[model samples]
Target: MTKLNLLLVIALLGSALVLVRTSYEGRRLFAALDRAKNEQRQLDIDYKRLDAERQAQATHLRVEQVAREKLQMRTATPAVTQYVGDRPHAASGVAR
Candidate 1:
């Protein structure tokens, strides 16, 4: 009877230790998951902000402004326009 009781007590202690260790590991994993979720949220916000900035930079007005200011480009006008063809008089429809 004494030996049986001692063996049962040892088994119970071992099971209790395992349960405590598992619980501690679970809490640690939960904390890591929370930190990862926060990081993901921050990354998502940054991506959205960058996408908005990209859209603003790609706008037509912004492109034209950059072209005119930085590239020294100008809009085409009739006075500056030129026409070309295979023959000199091909566009005017006059026989050579």
Candidate 2:
């Protein structure tokens, strides 16, 4: 009877240990999941911000402003344009 009591006590202690370890692992898993969710949320916000910035940069007015101010570029005037040919020339005999 004493040996049976001892065996019962050992089994109960082992079960308690298993329960504690399981609870610890559960809390750790929940913490990791929460951290991942927070990171995902932050990434989503960053992605939206970057997307908005890209849209602003891709606007025609913004592009033109950057080109004029940063690149010092200008549009060609009609007077500066040289038209080479108004009439079609006869094709030379160089066809395959």
Candidate 3:
């Protein structure tokens, strides 16, 4: 009977240790999950802000502004335009 009681106590201690370890692991995992969720929220906010900025940059006015300012570009006007016409070939003298 004494041996049986000792065995039961040993089993109970082992199970208690396992329970404590499982509970601790569960809490650690929960904290990690919470941190991951917070990080996801921050990433989502950043993505939305960047998307809005991209949309703003893609506007027609913004594109034209960047083009003219950065590229020193201007709209085509007839005064500044040139046209070329096909002429006869040098050797064959034909406008094929």
Candidate 4:
């Protein structure tokens, strides 16, 4: 009877230790998951901000401003327009 009681106590202690270890690990994993979710939210915000910046940079007015200021480009005007003649072969609709 004493031997049986001793065995039962040992089994209970082992089970308690296992439970404690599992609980700790579960809390650690939960904390990690929370941190990952926060990181994901921050990344999402960054992506949205960058996308807005990209859209602003790609606007037509912005493009024209950059072209005129940096590249010295100008819009086409009727006074400066020139007409070109098509190739003779193209006009005849035959391959050369």
Specify the highest-TM-score model's number: 3
TM for every model, in the order presented, reads: 0.78, 0.78, 0.87, 0.80
Off by over 4 Å in 2: 82-96
Cα displacement (angstroms), candidate 4, residue 65, comes to: 0.5
Give Cα-based local distance difference scores for all models: 0.96, 0.96, 0.97, 0.96
The parts of candidate 3 lying over 4 Å away from their true place are: 92-96
The residue-by-residue lDDT of candidate 2 on 1-96, one tens digit each, is 999999999999999999999999999999999999999999999999999999988999999999999999888899778888678867999886
For model 3, give the 10-residue run with minimal summed lDDT.
87-96
lDDT of 3 by residue, 1-96 (tens): 999999999999999999999999999999999999999999999999999999999999999999999999999999989999998867966766
* Local error of candidate 2 at residue 28 (angstroms): 1.3
TM-score of 3: 0.87
Native-vs-model 1 lDDT?
Answer: 0.96
Pitting candidate 1 against candidate 3, the one with the higher lDDT is 3
Per-residue alpha-carbon lDDT of model 4 for 1-96, expressed as tens digits?
999999999999999999999999999999999999999999999999999999999999999999999999999999888989876753666667
For residue 91, give model 2's deviation from the true position in Å. Answer: 17
Query: Candidate 2 has what TM-score?
Result: 0.78
Give the best candidate by lDDT.
Answer: 3
Candidate 4 yields a Cα-based lDDT of 0.96
